[model samples]
Target: MKDDEPEDTGSTLPRRQLGRLLREAREATGMSLEEAARLMEWGKSTLSRLERGKSERVRIRDVIGLCELFGTDEEKTAAIRELAEQAPVRSWWRSYGDVIAARFNTYLGLEAGASELAIFQPLIVPGILQTTDYARTLDRQYFSRDTDEELDRRVGIRMQRQHIITRQRQPVQLSVVLHESVLRTTVGSRQIMAGQLRHIADLSTRDNIQVRILPFRAGFPAGIVVSQFIIMSFPKDSRGKPVEPTVVFAESFTGDVYLEETGDVRRCRETFRTLQRATLDDRPSRDLMREIAREHDSER
Candidate 1:
């Protein structure tokens, strides 16, 4: 990283998507990055950066040269070049700055672009569905060192992401599956939990949103514990092919990981399907959520 090089505040999704496509195409031709670089008469690091989507600028001619070299079909080359052109565009979340971690910016971009999403939560509510108060409660604990203003901005971003699900045009088709434990788990207080449960129940009624709950009686699908994961699929292009591949997001205490390979994504999809079979139906899940919310309300 050069000292004079501009900082990457965010907005690398298109570049990252381009890089992944190019990398996959290159591998399909059975050529190593080093060999491709040598063949293109470009430095190895230059090709490496392009492949990793870490380059500051993506040149149209550069993409064309590589596509021609790899013998990529004209249709695919055009799509890949379009992605290159979009690489430098700014993302809305970039305005929030360090309030949003650099590691998390990519997921935000993917989430915004997703046409359909499958979210699984074994513990807490997913961020897009979290109410303002519920979000503040979680942030207050995790970002305890930050000033109130900083925390407010943090929560603000959470609320902004919800727009992708709520927009009147092209809203994401969202499916959320929660373990029954999430409804029972007390967050902040009984009152907060009541609001959160009711919130999910309300949102479940939307045409684009489906909420299902996995009960304890099901005893874990396949008797194996599954961590939280989100599977995001993109819209198709004029050719009826995905603009970008399906991506599976798995978050942890530290950094996150994205699974993009066909087999891995299929496995996650199957896992989600298996879990869905064990979950209560739409009406039943809403009933359970409301039932729990009432129990919280009745509590002294």
Candidate 2:
């Protein structure tokens, strides 16, 4: 395989990858799920659910057992084990369970394993990079059942998700474009907004993260519809094909919609390019953020 060839990280879905890897290893050894379950002393149905990625959670012990039973080579075993370790203990957005929302959890799952993310946030800051204060303020305004604890939990998860950028192995490339309105709008108090803007300025300095701001001067473009969405891409598989379909996630007040068809993907890419053309470049965007911060400080 070429040095840049993407390994079959098992499942295209991050949450399901571990289970799929385990199943593949077991089957390669010509063992049935029941046989593997017996070797591991786990219930057959439990093993089956994991293989199907239907389980809500994955256990480390189960991963170790499957690895041993299948006698998987070191590389494959290590990859599967890593996925098992990286799996979230619970859905990050579970705190918002009472809210009527889309299946954002699935999106989060896919994002966890994505190689790159291109985001266009026309209304507000992207959730993964929002500071705690901004997140809490936005959550309170949007969610009716909000509480201090829930807000804190959600914000904490958002912060944790940012670690995907700094993680040792394969860090995700993040390119984000925010509307100029996002910088001008104060979601929280003046002090909080200033801090948030400063945070954005600092984050833009990171090598793996790119930030741009779309100016209002670029009036109603074809892409400036009422919707906001993100496009995610993963590394290609052994056959030089994307393991999972590239997805466009569009969010509404009521719920979210995911588009995976070829035409939709093309449209999303074209819209993103148009939005990029409308945006200020990175240096100017950071300058704009700093300027906003100064304005917020002066108002106080």
Candidate 3:
């Protein structure tokens, strides 16, 4: 990657890339965010959101003005202009906007760019690995206000995201640690849970995917007591240099919290290591999953 050119970060999502560019340009000007917002006649929150890649739409004219203010050269300015123009185009998830949370939309964008995903689930299956029937069952129970159409759309989004793991081109490396309770809990029905377990077993066979079971005998880690979380890492640039920093995602009833600080990321990584030490290896984990699936099938 060229020094001046933005690193690919494996993120083809142009809107996010555009946001990073704007933030970098502002910093190069050595102006505080408040000062820049004042000069641009924009609210501080708006500018902050734009810089953080939270905004869904960015104005091309504003990009031009900001590029000029930042003293960016003509060639670089034109490139940024093009990104701004493309930022408003709808991503595949845009059509499901009404069904999913706005915060989740941002997560989806980052997930698409990430090269590796390490997830730990204590209560249930992660959305990325959930079957359609299982997803529908969970969504219907949790989103009581949603109509059937909305529920279907939300499940569709989850199902589509699984492609990141199974797709032929640029498949992501996935490591999942599931608490044993996840297999024990009946999600939709005996049949549904059985299918979900079988699906997980199938996914574990893939070369790029690793699944482990954290049993009850091995006490739960303090770090995971808060809730389930996903840690995502983006690929290096063409020159094999680090591009995007690792991100830790935790979702709650209110919204999602993303931790990017080096210290925060270190803690999460360490916690994962602790969990891994207590987990059943892939082979045993697969066997246990199949065993559980058999129990569910018997009940069905």
Model 3: per-residue Cα lDDT over 44-116, one tens digit each: 9988877765676677788888888889876667657766665342221222232224322557868888888
lDDT of 2 by residue, 1-300 (tens): 012433333333445656667776888988888887787788999889788666777777777777877898776666676666664322112222322122225467668877888898888888877888898888787665868887778778888888887676778888888888888887878888899999988988888888998888977666447367788777776778766656677766545555555566677878887878778888999999999999999997
* TM-score of each model, in listed order: 0.70, 0.68, 0.69
| Candidates arranged by TM-score, highest first | 1, 3, 2
Worst 10 residues of 1 by lDDT: 1-10
lDDT of 1 by residue, 76-189 (tens): 786677667763532311222332233235577789888889999999999999988999999999889989999999999999999988888989999999999999988899
lDDT score of model 1? 0.81
Give the winner by TM-score: 1 or 2: 1
Best by lDDT: 1
- Given candidate 2, what's the lDDT at residue 46? 86
Which one wins on TM-score?
1
> Which residues of candidate 2, in runs, are more than 4 Å off?
1-104, 144-146, 223-226
Q: lDDT: which is higher, 2 or 3?
A: 3
Model 2 local distance difference test score: 0.73
lDDT of each: 0.81, 0.73, 0.78
Off by over 4 Å in 1: 1-104
- Angstrom error of the Cα, residue 84, model 1: value is 14
